[model samples]
Target: MAGYGRSDEEWGQLTSVGLAFLVERARLEKTTTYTELDATLRRRTGLRGFDFDQDSERAAMGHLLGLIVERNRPTTNLLISALVQYLNTNDAGPGFYALAVELGMLPRRSSATAKQAFWIGQLNALYAFYSAGRRGA
Candidate 1:
């Protein structure tokens, strides 16, 4: 995906949600260090050199989110907007599952839990938002 400029507010919002997802995943997986999470993400996505600090999960997540948002600003902003809209109109959930799936962060054939399904919807909405933005651009 191409990068697009985003406001500070948009970046903050996206970072917040992304961090939440990372934290929750860490908690669920019982990870004690940022290295674990970094390794997991790399293994799952087949990417490398994420710059995880190895100090704290929170710091690592912040750094990773910053890099991802900066690298894929348009899609990240659309993901954040879709997440916020879902939160306001529907329910609480991580908004990154679909983005994750697209980026190979999650497996495509994996059956989503209820919470994940909600996020999946947000992911689908992101595609719609991105399409609209591309047209306008």
Candidate 2:
């Protein structure tokens, strides 16, 4: 939970932007890369978004995504971050799985396949929740 120089209000705004973008993407049954999300955040917030190449910034994005998860956990109980993936590899970062384990959504001692299963489950749930009734409407 490092602040990374972002104030509470800033975090709130950034998280709001990210959540809205992700929800919309989910409704379209689409996935976005970290760089794409960062660009969207910068354009929407008028702030210098994370470089994403830097480790610190990557961690910051993870933290921001974690906040998104925490914000919607009560209603959805799903990792919305599952819709986000690394650009080089079409997979969520380790932090995504870490957050799942931290929240007890994924078992701590799970195998790689088990972890992937959990991520896929969350993603399918997200797609179902948002994509339902969104098409041809």
Candidate 3:
């Protein structure tokens, strides 16, 4: 779709139906917490719950990826770490905040536009790198 972190065939790799439902459900329920979204995903997909208590951000992301297995959602901590590396390499953004909320690291309903701006800035910077990577060897 017309948004950040989107691709022409984003639908190409994602478990379209499942991820769509999960994203929609999270939005509908006003559920900003990662745990809530995970629970919803598990319930909908009949999958196991993530172990956030263990500081497993990677595992948490994997659970989401596992649910959205059709697309490249990322399946390990390495992906999350890579994303973090990319983010800090420049700055962060709304997408990053959404990710933080989805990971239960940050909550939804942010009042701090400054924080959102910071996150958005970070995202734009990373996008530039990824875009460049796509055009090169």
What are the clash counts of all predictions, listed in order? 0, 0, 10
Descending-TM-score candidate ranking: 2, 3, 1
lDDT of each: 0.43, 0.84, 0.41
TM-score of 1: 0.28
Mark the regions of model 1 whose C-alpha exceeds 4 Å error after superposition: 1-50, 63-112, 132-137
Model 1 deviation from the true structure expressed as Cα RMSD, one decimal place: 14.3
Better of 1 and 3 by lDDT: 1
lDDT of 2 by residue, 71-117 (tens): 87676778899989988776788989989988888989999899888
lDDT of 3: 0.41
Please, what is the TM-score per model? 0.28, 0.91, 0.34
> Which of the predicted structures, 1 or 3, would earn the higher TM-score when compared with the native?
3
Question: How well is each residue in 1-137 modelled by candidate 1, as lDDT tens digits?
Answer: 11233345544544454444443432333212334545555554444434534545344444445454444445344333223222124432233444555655457666647545645565564445444234221
Q: Rate residue 114 of model 2 by lDDT.
A: 92
RMSD of 3: 13.8
Model 3, span 26-105: residue lDDT tens: 22322134545455556765545555566464344443444352242342111121122221234332345555567654
Off by over 4 Å in 2: 133-137
